[model samples]
Target: MTRLSSPAHLRQVRTGNMHAVLVAMLDGPASRAELAQRTGLTKATVASLVEPLLGQRILAEGAVVNAGRGRPSRPLRFAATGPVAIGAEINVRHLGVTVQRLDASTEFERRIEVDNCRATAADIVTRLADLIRTAIAACGRDPLGIGLAVPGIVQDGAVVHTPNVPSLNGIHLGDQLAAELGRPGTTVAVDNEANLAALAHVWPHRLAGDDFVYVSGDVGIGAGIVIGGAMFRGRSGFAGELGHVIIERTGHPCPCGSRGCVEQYAGLDAIFQAAGKRDLAALLLALDHGDPRALAAVETASAALGAALAALINICDIETVVLGGSYAALFDHIAPGVHTELDTGVLAATRRPIHLTTSAFGRAAVTRGAAALITRRHCLEPNLLLPPGRRQ
Candidate 1:
């Protein structure tokens, strides 16, 4: 062991070593020797670091593996039951909660439809807190932390602006949710839903590669930009406001006080109005029946969405785009129009391929991404798994 005179320095080294071990295990189960080789630490050090994690129920020993020549070793894996993370989302049409283990396996999940647009911020927070509590109870464990997804601009745990859900503007949602949950010092991270959704694609695995954009469609439209396998929140943390980008100077009015924004044409509300459908289910049904109105509505929305995406791609120089939320549901109906616009509007389309796809999670992507935020933090800073008094 390297000796350090300062206690803080020793703690920092230990935390770093522990983080290395945890991150190595993220690939799968590994023995002490494997961890040592992967993290470039001595086997003795790996054993010492992993002991506390096993004692704390963060890691468990799996079946013994034969090394061919040496003694069989027991592989260690993330425990299936301990130190779960909570993910919650507050959207215009619904509230969702997801509890996931360190391995990214969902343990408990729930989603409920509600007219959040008609509710006050406080009321919505109360409802979201209830869902979180229920999830915690269902999981039967205290969450290591909570991650919240909201459809708006977030800066330093506060919502700076949310045009569709106006009540949340200027609210420090993370702090309020932590207080409401009666866990004052617990970590409650708040971020734009689209950003989180984009993260969900990257953390466990890079579903969209290192450079890509995730565009979310709902009652509001937004984009989550990823570069170098990390989220690209601009200088002010309000970078991916794809909905506000102007498409038609004199087009339909938008809630963000803009005219001809892509959201005005491509958002679910606009599609419903154009298709004469009451809700997504109805619109999906209309599309299934090959109704001309529904097809036309989707075609128009897709063209506008593609145009906005073209501008985003041109500026960011990203080659991949993943359609999420309602867009994922309507991919078959709307993809051709988006593809046509991309081919025409994207300057590099002829030289480099532009890949467009749908999110596997659909609308649940936001909540899943929120959960990943917590787990990723824990993996990077394993000291967070310790009791407050012991974490230095």
Candidate 2:
């Protein structure tokens, strides 16, 4: 069988025409001819690639539309039903789970603000298992997989380290959750929240050539980097620990056994401390109303973030920085401080404008991206999940 080369030059590990067709459809609904033209595949090749998807109910045909005159071509679109994907996030102050289908539509969601920092790993896993059960029920069919968004480093199925949630450290969360759920064919995948957050930008958008930095601010701070439309996971999976970047040589001690780290100054806790407010909602309201204290505290934290980002931009040469999590909510108020610090710290800011934007997924970025990870795996390379004797 002849393999179709990807038109966009993506790193496709599998040799097949299916990936090309799916990638073309991501732009929008397209007819077979349109898909073939865009993907650089022959018309017959497109039909062959699409046949399996249509049979599996992964792709559906819309009504026949008149283009020129002779024959109307039915457009192909991602099916909204069946094969749902699950994504979960374990935050210090919240637990968020998103049930999404292949088309990125939310079927069901559960979010509760429960402080799990002090909760034991077993307890956290138990809560997540219950939530996963609910999501699985909502799916009502064999799901693609479940992806976990953790605030810590994840190596294998275990949490490597987390400064914000110490109880999660050294816990085999993926394996435990799989064992607890005990549902056959329900696979579990895990990764850092920020890394998945970065993947969110590229996943649904399908902008494989974009290069940017995604910074997530919450109880803690972390970064996700996208270079050439792919995630730069670095030599180790621990690449984007932007929070641990040192800002002051002898400043406040950090939970990661460091002093003067970026998180110490710009993290949610630091901003809350600076504002003298125990509640974030109240502080955000005050900042919106132009309260002097709230403004000052947010500005101070934004400056720290900018300082850390300057070094990052220089090293990565990324022009875009996307603020996610709490940062997105406070973007209007804190953007100036980040810009000012960038102008001062970044060497090439004068030549190239440093563009900043808010995440499209907002606080749900990580979990949604986690779900997208599984969807991407299935779309780009379906052979891994193929049933025995199922022809590719």
Candidate 3:
């Protein structure tokens, strides 16, 4: 027996009209002409797409109010009530999970701390499945998909490589966890944490444009790239492995078998070790107490980070850079050194316009980006919202 009948699923897929409805709502309330202009589809095409969606109650039409000297425009908007999607961000030390409607209004949220990233892949899957099940029970919504943002390399929805964390070196983390969840038709999506943070942070400021970079420092360092308004996950899905890039040939030994890697200096462990503390909070407390050693370590890390960012600016030329993660709070202390490096290292022609700022979402941005990843753009398709067995 075919576990899930394709013909039946296809019929259901055709009935929902979710894609067209979501596209309409994304443009805000608009008339046919307004939506057409914003979406770049002809007015007739917009009408054709919207009619079925309207019938399904996914798209709502308002009164055709009269506009003087023109056709009365009937505005359309997405129905506020519909299926909601869940986004989960699994980091080295914690998980940030959120649930929101397809229209982007957030519902409930929760965070939980699990075992260290050193936990075996099986352990990770079991614990993650439990967390997700708990979230589903709490949210009480039909989840369309699950988006996971992890601190490592992702290719075709799997964690094929995690350089900083040895236990996850070769695990197909996504597929295993998805299977453990027992939601066969549920869509599971995965991406590097930095990439998701970049998407989550840049989406709100998208009116300014899409080309930007997101850099985060935590247990490890990572970067997410956005070019031409879309994530550019380069060949082999390791494009943004900025943390492993050799900064100094003989600086310090990194666990990834490299010396003087960015993570050796910019990662939380390095900062803590340099400050002679077990935690970043303790180091910050020492800094507050006028502990010179702690303060010096912070400055050194900042200068190294600044130099690295400047080098990247010379190469990528992104318009903006957003810093995130557990160590993002250090941006305030290191701004001076970062400024100094950017002033000196970036090419003169492309230097002045680049802006560096701390991420507004802080540690939660990567998780939010994971959620967005499951539902945004050409990425969204019928299978995105389909039940598990029907999905590829």
Candidate 4:
């Protein structure tokens, strides 16, 4: 078998072709010619790559479409039943794990409290793997991969520095979980949870376009940068650190070692503590009843969020900004204030409307994005979640 040569200028040709075809099939079913047209590859070249995928049961061909006068054409599609992928997102006080098919449609999800995320590295990984395994088992599918989304700086697909969860720092989580799971075909990837949430905001819209950003405000605050429709991991692969952006100089202390950082004011733990709540539902109810303390927390968090958005929009100038995570719903209470802040802080106010929206997928955004990552990794390189010209 002749191996495809890596393009001297294109980095890796086989990988590129494989990813392109896989992405196309994941989009739905398409004929070889249609794939060629979509991927800009010759039919012969596409077929060569498609053969191996077919042999591996990764790609399936079915149903002939009569092309007016020619013989029926068999369309290529991805075998969703081939394997399953799991995504685990660990928040400041909760653990969320989800299992979904390779095509990214979720099958089962489980979320529970971990109290203090300050547990030791081994303990966190061990427990997280157990929860993920349970979810995967419930799905009744053979797990093919796992994606871990944690807070802090993720370097080279590992949790390098986690300020929120100190014990997770310096752990090669991807390697550790791969050993623990012991599934021969299972591989693991790790990334910043905020980055994953950001990607979750835009990943589904990639098939349409990739010019958006997601501002994730949960227990902590952070932003995900997507440019040309892909998660833009900067020089260090930890580009979206929106939470730590200094919004105030002397108001509150932040875990990221800064005064008045956005995380300090808008982080969930801080807000919940200030509100003196043991259950989030109770606090939300209090906020609904117009409790002064709850309302104050919401107002303070929203104002800080609005200020952060203003700064982010002014700097990045992306088309759409999505607020995801637990605090996304609070946007309604603060949109007016946010609008005022945006008008004052951003440049050329009228050119791009600065459409601020909340995640349609709600809390499930990150897990869904993890599913999206699985599709991106095992199937295709280009995105396929949204249709072109319809991403908003």
Worst 10 residues of 4 by lDDT: 383-392
lDDT of 2 at 27: 80
Candidate 3 per-residue lDDT over residues 1-392, each given as its tens digit? 43356787755544344354455567577888887777666777677667655665556788887988988898887556556567787777777787756556566677877655678777776877887888788777667788887888877766777765557766766678778998777777878889888877655336326777788788788888888888888878888787887789998988777899988887888888888998757887887897988888878888788788888878888767777887567777766777777777788535365677877777777777777766573225634443455442
With a 3 Å backbone cut-off (N, CA, C), the pairs that clash in candidate 2 are: none
Better of 1 and 3 by lDDT: 1
The reply for model 3, stretches above 4 Å from the true place, is 1-21, 31-37, 40-48, 54-57, 60-76, 202-208, 288-290, 349-353, 377-392
Query: Could you give candidate 1's per-residue lDDT for residues 178-286 as a string of tens digits?
Result: 8898988989999999999999999877888999999999999989999999899999988989988999999888888889999999999999999999999999999
State the displacement of the C-alpha of residue 13, model 2, in Å, after optimal TM-score superposition.
12
For the record, the alpha-carbon RMSD of candidate 2 to the native fold, in angstroms, is 3.7
Q: Rate the local accuracy (lDDT) of all candidates.
A: 0.91, 0.83, 0.73, 0.72
Instruction: Give the winner by lDDT.
Output: 1
lDDT agreement of model 3 with the native: 0.73
Off by over 4 Å in 1: 1-8, 388-392
How does model 1 score by TM-score?
A: 0.95
Worst 10 residues of 3 by lDDT: 377-386
lDDT of 4 by residue, 138-225 (tens): 8776665777888778887767777888888788888887777776456677888777877665543452246777877777777788
- Per-prediction TM-score, please? 0.95, 0.92, 0.83, 0.83
